[model samples]
Target: MNFSGLLTLQKERVPLKSIEVELEVRDHVATVVSTLNYENKKNKPLEAVFVFPLPGDAAVCHFSAKIGQTQIVAEVKEKQKAHEEYDDALSSGQQAFLLEESDQSPDIFSLSVGSLPPGESASIRLEYVTELAVQADDGLRFCLPAVLNPPFNPQYKYRGRKCKSFEVVYVPASWLSYSLSFSARVSSPRPISKVESNCSLDPLQYLNTDQTQATVKLAAGHKFDRDVELLIYYKDAHQPTAVVEGGQASAEPGTLMGDPMVMVSLYPEFPETVMSSGTSCGEFVFLMDRSGSMDCAISKSEQEETRMSSARDAVLLLLKNLPMGCYFNIYSFGSSYEHIFPKSVEYSQETMEEALKKVNQMEADLGGSGMLEPLKHIYNQPCIPNHLRQLFVFTDGEVWDTKDVIDLVKKNSDSHRCFSFGIGEGTSSAPINGMAKEGGGHAQFITRSDRMQAKVMQLLRFALHPTVTVTWDLPKEVSVTVLSPPIAILFKGQRSLIYAQLTGQSSEAAEGCVTVKYSLAGHPSENQLHFSLRPAEDTGLTVHRLGARSLFRSLEREEREHKEHEDGGVKEKLVQLSVQSGVSSSFTAFIPVNKDNGDTIQGHFLRRNIPKPCEFTGRNFKW
Candidate 1:
């Protein structure tokens, strides 16, 4: 089950090695310039071409790249408004960065690798300008959308969904701690039913007590730090979700229920950051959910070993790829659990032999179990960066205390980013997504064992980002509407980020009034300072993705739950989303939507029923 069997090496090798994006904000619009470096690291010769998904509608300017004799570069000039929400990103998923919900429009876009000689690297640069339309709302409330495609809007998706993103130069300043806080202040107040906190989720819930604000006064030479959770949430009305508080409430159609204002708060202190006094190492934690139901046989498949075999192979492949300075621990759970190593085992000859010996002997036998316990243990466990703590939990869908475990992960953001790997028989994706989101982590679906290495390596590369911590600030006069949560910028790596779509405008638009905030290392006095924006061009992709990511995530949440219970409304919303993103989806595996628009492609995993608030009557979508 080594995933190499699945590889189809491209005989036509056009490799892109380096990518970069530069953004300049002027008035209400942002001028974006991008560069993609393509070079042959291969031992053979090749030719590559830049394949862009977007057509010439948005005013594009093409640049060229020369990697020795091979060259490729593409650019586009798009007009956008400052902060105007994009509800149409899904339709243009492969072309835009924001994963918004829209009628999927298929545009022929791609990149082809042509001629490349052995052992050579080339660089490419592209530049473009965008002026998005800005809408001013009285309330500081906005919805940051996400596409279940990347699980959020990534620059790339399942089948290479292209979106706007950036490449950054990460300069590591030793002893200097940096904090990154991003948010979308709603134009109106919105209520939040579920949130992560150190305290219990009770009526009188409180903020985090696990850590405290840094009392060390920061000066030019000071390196004091702590990690803070930058929460962008709506002001919620007193209402109960199905489980927490009091469980369940009715949403009267005419009754405008929850608050719409999404408050942006930097937790722990005014300026939040983290500084590690210890050396950084790479450590991997294998957290497996051994719930009893994972024993179920794959339907229509020849054997019951189908699921177990896949899970085992993936873990093994992961182990084989361990890099130097890497250490690992394995935890499996059913109603109870077992840790292969009481502590981490380095990638030494003896350690590897022993760990592999134990791994080979380990058996998959467990009852239905909970996820919270192991998560807590990992949080409390001692860890250092070189340890590179990565807990890869493989399960076959059975889970408990799902939300609670998610909260636990979020509360410990300073320590770990738990990547939830789900491989099961029709399990709901909501809880899994919630788990990753809570941990500020990532989630992936492993249906077959053959795809594990590529998937896992993708995660590894994502974790290898040079900028462990990064942040950006919106200028004065202009505001941005972040449409979605963070996604892989260039290729789903954490460093490549597209904030929720936000509006930008000149202060004069609101009779001249605006303030911007930035969380930095040395500047504490004017962190929440003011800036401005004026109108520019308007191709409208930014506005679209902002609205798209927000809407898509909500639908994805509902869709996963509907799948769990076999509801109908889930189908309807899914169809709508599929149409919006142009991806082929089923209740089974989801296909990448980059190739086709809504016209010819059709297959969806949408919800067929939308429970009328408190009542579970399942309303259907028009699709």
Candidate 2:
């Protein structure tokens, strides 16, 4: 059938009934469980496909389905094997479900429900764990994308033809055939200060007098047009804390999930004298995205500003606020790249005004998103004397060669620091965050309601701050094997997380101290946290799963970089860890089959593709 015909049929009989989400937050970590209900109304057995989005760093650990009284739990296995098993079960008249990550981006996923009999209902459950991002205001931020209302319509070529595009439709929460129910429970070592959200929410209810635990729910009749974001505030958020979790008993002793893991959160502080004295000398390079997608509005609002205009305004503000005598340049890229100056120029009134005029006149005339070549060009330039090079990148779309781009940044990290900004909804977070992390910089996202100038200015402050170094000190008896990469960038009041595996043993009453030493602007400073050596009880394998994910990403990057020299060892390690920890990875998928042979029907099933809501734009997307 044609794409338009499929969409029309989808509108006539929507299979989705409701979505229920439960979130549990422990300090900086959050665990989410979501249940999706679907019922078939047609007279024939059908297979349904639904594509959705998740947090880029999340680890999906569990997936299962319930059909009537029968329950089937999914297991992580090799991607090819999972696909074969799913097909085999479908052909045998058994119900099956397959969940796999997208090859183009980590944030997107595709789920397939096969052999769903007519008039039958199925419930799908998915669980994931993610670290809450520290916001500019010290509030931990969590977002649930509104995938049903406007839908997440990612553009991809099907059978050499472009799929029909649909305008953004605003379906009110009350008007949607599918309903959403959300509730969250938060617990922290520090006292909870407050909870806030963009959507309407019920009043916060504290579970104890100390205010360390609380519960909140989304208010009824809330709109699903925009993502549901939660910002949780805590008293004394800068205090360093450590959480130690024991490993899984079922896994091998030497495996990642079987060992003890500790997560340390640090917020570095500089001396007052150094903090007040901001550096004035630096080389600033700003890169802007001029792809066609930038022409779309920043949000779904009727009068919202376009992403291009917002980025242009932010660049103008940066130009105006730049420190005098600093070296700077401006570059724009789409399929091709253009630079205003041949090389870095000293910042002055003449240069600032020249850059501003050109930025204001810039438009989104470029055809596709191609960032690697321009980034390579920028890195190829030699650094100016006595001026630390600081790179700023702005984009509203995804690029196919994300790993290559990140690897390039890592190769040139010693000469410069990179700051990245993702503009508009549905922007891929993998590349935006990856480039920043690899380049020793910070990443920012600008949503529909965010003012680009404010975030840009905040990052500018970080750029002007003196570069800092980090050293970790632990007890002599207990050594730590850091799972995450070395600390590359540090900013005042921003949280830096470190995951480590602790070996050896200490007495239950003994205290273990960890210190972070750094030199800020030629002055040495340190922050330390002392906690009991005994691992905490009743804490699930959250730390282990997160650590596994960190290691998986590191290995994946290494595998990509050494594709010529390496054998299949790296891929094997990744698959082993993913299957052992029950976490989803690029090499593995979650597949579960209901093998119940009772009352098997012997007919072929029809395939039906469920249409997901697309954003309100017509930009062509590449996979």
What is the lDDT, from 0 to 100, of the residue 25 in candidate 2?
A: 88
Question: What is the per-residue lDDT of model 1 for residues 1-623, given as tens digits with 9 covering 90 to 100?
Answer: 00100011232324443334443322122334555554465686543333332211111223344455433332211112101222232343212111111122111122222234567665544433222211111011111111000011111111112111111121233422222122111111123222221112223222233211111111233111111111112232211111001101242221111101111212112111221222335778888754434443322122344445556666777777676677888887765678888887777767766766766655444533556677777777899654546667676544565445655665675566676665642333445555655555666654434445666665554343222222335445334443345332111222112333233332443322222333223232222312122222322233232233344444555665566788868666655543343222222112112222322112211211111101112352111
The CA-based lDDT of model 2 is what? 0.73
Deviation in angstroms for 282 in model 1?
A: 1.5
Writing each residue's lDDT as its tens digit, candidate 2 over 115-234 gives: 667788878788998888776677888888765434433332222222222123344445557778999999877899999987899999999999988999999976555778899999
TM-scores for every predicted model: 0.38, 0.88
Among these predicted structures, which one has the highest lDDT?
A: 2
Q: What does the lDDT read for residue 414 in candidate 2? A: 90
Cα displacement (Å) at residue 576, model 1: 26
